[model samples]
Structures are given as C-alpha cells and as structure tokens.
Target: MNARTPRLEEVASLAGVSTATVSRFLNNPAMVAQQTAQRVQAAIVETGYLPNLNAGALASNRSRLIAALVPDIAQSIFNDTMEAMIEQLSADGNSVVMSLTGPDNRRLEAQIDAALSRRVDAIILTGIVSDLETRKRLKSQSATVIETWGLPEDPIDVAVGFSHAAVGREMARFLHGRGYRRPHLVVPRSGRSQARASSFAEHWMADGGEQPSILEVNIPSHFGQGRLAFRGLTDLEHRPDVVVCGSDWIAQGLLVEAQAAGVRVPDQLAVTGFGNLRLAGDMRPTITSVDIDGARIASEVHRILRARAAGEVLPSSLVDVGFRIIARESA
Candidate 1:
C-alpha cells in the first residue's frame, strides 16, 4: 500500500512511447515531435518522475558545466570579471563552478583534475599556466580551456586579457612623462604582479633611469601591506619621488599612510596603481591607475565560449582587451 517512486520506464509506459523517445523528450524536447513531446511531458507530470541529469549527461556526452578557477575571490580586482561571466553563462543555461586555488600551481592542477573528472565542458583559468606539468596535463585533456588576464603569444587554447608587460611599461612611461624620477615599485611576492614589476624595471632602465627600488610584499596585495611597503621605501637611503603600486588597494593604503605622516600627495610624493578599482575615484586626490576593462574581458570570454560551443572555428585564439592609464590627481 506504499506509493512507489516513479521511473523512466513508468513514464514511458504512461506516455505510450519507448524509453528512448521519452529520453529524447526529456534531454532535448526540440528533437522530439511536438505532439509526442507533449505526451511525454504530461506523463512526467502524472508520474512525478525526476530525470537524473547524470544519466542524461552520460547519454548525451554533456554535463552543461563550466569550471572557473580564480586566485582569490576576496580581491575585488577579479570580482567584476567573475560576476559578468557568471551572469552571461547562467543566462545561456550553463552552471559555473568556481574554485579558488590561490597562486599555487599544484593546487590549481588538482582543481583542474577535479573539474575534468566531473566532465566539465569548459574551464576558465586566471592568468597563464607557468607550471610545465600542469600545462601538459591541461593540454592532454579534451575540455575547452581559456586563460584570462592577457593573451599570451602562445596560449594553451584561447586567452582573453590585457598585457601585463604593456601595463608595466605604460606605468613607467606615464610616471616618467610626469617628471617623476626615482620611482619605486611595490608588488605582491608572487603571481602576475611579478611580470608587471619586471617589465616596469626594464622600461625604467631603458629610459636611462637608475635602477628603482622594488619592494615585494607578502602574497595577496592589500592595504596593510601597502602601508608596510611605504614604510620600507621610506627606509631607503634616497626616498623615491613616486611610488607605483601593483593594485589600487595598495595605492589607497599608501595614500592613507602618506596623509597620516603629513606627506603631501603629488606635491611631495606621487602615486599610481594598477586595476583602477572602484574606490580609486572615491579616495581623496583620486588615484592614478591603469584601467583594464573587466566587463569587456568577460564579454569576450563569453563570445569565445559560445563560438566554441557551436563548433565554429575561431579565427584567432588570442584577444587583447588592452589597458588604459587614467591620469588622476594623485600623479
């Protein structure tokens, strides 16, 4: 006298169709005849059968899943791009699974393995894969791979981002043009910031400028670290006339510390940061920053993914979103 759970067979029996026909209706209603699909839908409603998506995926060879691996979700620098990508993917009926692997290549590889095990259709990775083993494993996999932040000359698959090297050179040029010599660089200990810092140093030297003092803080650039970096720069024999921070959070911190120390901005010291974060404009003596359009990066990512999904060959695998140096009161 107990009610039993309904099965696909029961739904198929009620719909007066074979199990294959019912499955076609459930997985892709458009593939089935309209009248037949309606009959299967009515049977599904009557029998209260829940289609197992895993089973459906096995049959159709699609999980409808996309995995996105970011370094840190707490950083607002990546939030805009993440949010925009998620919104667009959701609208297209794809589920995004986000995993934070920090900047550790081993951890990122593990996450990639897990995503591949789950049979994800695509993967969005932040920055280039520097680890050879990880890159090899990724290349061996069949999933569609996309590396963001900036398109590399040779990408794993497809890449969408601005050039960190270009950004660094631009920062150096911008400060040099403003008559700010004796520049100092503050960056996180690891990750793409290193590339920016290196490029900045190279450009500074090429311009016949003396070697700038580069301060490497702990991983994950933050306001507190910015303060520490500023203090460290102050300890140098000859203090820098201008400080270029890797991100706005750090630049803003430097500004706050400068104000507290009675140091006048732009007059006594100049400051600039990358990312052009939202708070950049909100800060007093608004921050000078290099702006990369996160929304546009996300849009391009979506477009490339859509094209790949449709089995269309892309003319180019790399897309350069470019960067902008916004001159503000601070520099």
Candidate 2:
C-alpha cells in the first residue's frame, strides 16, 4: 500500500478480473468484451485501484482524450490555432487527439462516425458543419462539442468564435473609409468561407457600392489558385479596386498573383484576409487581415471545461473571443 508502489493485481482484484485480463483490457482494450470492461471498472472503484486511462479506455467507457477535428492541418493559421488549443487542453490534463477531414463530403462523414465510436471526453470541430448527417452524428455523441472559427445562429452545443458575416461588413466599411468604392471578394470554397463571402457581398452592396463581384476557389489556399481566382478581376467590365479573402492563405496567394501580374497592391488593388497568421506581417507588402484571437479561443475553451467539471452550467454559450482588422501595407 506504499504511495509510490501502485499494484495492478490489487486493482485487478478490486475490479474482479484476472490480472491477465486486466492487462489486456488496459493495454489492448479493443480485445476486451464490453461487459467485462464494465466489471473491471466497478472493481477498480471499490478497491480504489485507479488504473490510468490505459486500462479503462481499453475496456469500455470514455477515453480521456479530446479530439480536434481540422479540415486542413497544413494551413498556417489553423495549424497555430490547433497547436495552442492542444497545448491548453493538455495542460489541463486532457490528451489531445486529431482526426483530419478531407475535402470529400463522404470521407468527412466517415471520420465523424469513427471519432464518435471512440467515445472521447470532448470534441473540438474547426469550421462549421455543413452536412446535416455529420451534424446529427456529432450532436448524438453528446460530448463537449465546440465549433470554432465561425459562429452560427444555432450551434449544436458549445461554440467559441468570431462572426464571419460581421467580418465582411466591417471590411466593407473599412474599404469605403479608405476611399475604395469597387471591392471584390476572393474566398476559398469552405463551409465558413461561404458565409463570409455571401455576407460580404450583401454588406458591400448595402454600403452604396455597386454589386459585389466574387471569386471563389478550392481549399488549402494555395498561391497558384489565389493567382487564378483573383485574375480577370481587373478586367471585370467594371474593375474592383479591393479584394477580401477567406483566410490569409488565400490572401497571400492573391498578393503573389497580383504581384506576378504586375499589379501594385493597395495602390492598385487593396487586399484583406482573415485568420491573421504570423506570415501575414512578414509578407513583402505585409497583408492587412482580420485577427482572430487563437489564444483567447484557447483560454475560453479551458474556462468552459473547468466550469463544466465543477457542475456549473456554462455561462457563455456564444463566446466572441473577438477579431481586429490590421491596417497593413496591403490594405
């Protein structure tokens, strides 16, 4: 019973299973039957043989792991945001797990189902859920569901993020203030990006500007696509004087494309991007972007989990960590 010497047999005896079975249940949980897993858990409670997650997760019950569902990990802004989120969660004694979603709708659905089967403690989803089936599956899991990056009218559970629609409105006003009448919205075809793109179009027209012309492309924000999407904007019967992008990745590509095309930025075509990544400031012309506070998002998520664990009803269902428009060289 030495404090430093915790024995598995004592825990096994308490859980009412052979030591060998306990070992498999903990190390190779997928091998244990569900009924047997519950028995081990009951014994552990009585004998106070608190086996770490290695055992219990192997048998049955929740995994002390939190899964962060990200569509693209290589995108610089999301990479940083997820890293901070994972760090903050791990510091609070939770294991951080990841499940990458592809561009395909069916693949994303399969990934969601697989994540639910694992029965993790919490689920953190990046972007909005467009697929109704995927959203239903996530809601059915009943875990601490969190949708970050964009806020929706009715989030399934908990959500912490900035409003993409508002981002568009503010950008239009900012452009108008700077004396830019004609604006073009360049965005990736992402779940949340569509919101920003559509809202930006409405807000820009409402602000007394002519109809907003939009250029939409695929995901991951590659430089080549940016060049193509922003191309011909200058030739749009009535050329747009400014461009707003879904993310800095798209903006970066737009900037590169504009430069290669011999168009001077800000002076010729002002560009604004979302998810103010570090590289934004370092870009040659220095991209002007909306700063979505990843650090604040991490802090708020941790605060919510702590409050929930203490049996307190979460006070903030919609947490706006806030966003800021950085006035840089590009815009």
* Each model's backbone clash number: 1, 4
Clashing pairs in 2: 14-43, 15-43, 26-55, 29-58
1-331: candidate 1 lDDT, tens digit per residue = 9888899999999999999998777654656888998899899999999888787678777787899998887865888999999998776657899998874444787899899999998999988888777777888878899999966777888899978888888888888888988998898766678889999999988998889988887767788877887778758988999998988999999999999899999899999988999889999989999888999988998888788767899999889999999999999
lDDT for each residue of candidate 2 in 105-153, tens digit (9 for 90 to 100): 3356666667677777787877777767667767776678888877867
lDDT of each: 0.86, 0.77
Top-scoring candidate (TM-score)? 1
Query: Cα miss at 37, model 1 (Å)?
Result: 15
Error of 1 at 286 (Å): 0.8
For lDDT, the strongest prediction is 1
- The C-alpha stretches of model 1 lying farther than 4 A from their native spots are 1-51
> In model 2, where do residues sit more than 4 Å from their true spots?
1-51, 54-62
Candidate 2: Cα lDDT at 119: 73
**Ten-residue region with minimum lDDT total, candidate 1:** 22-31
Error of 2 at 21 (Å): 26
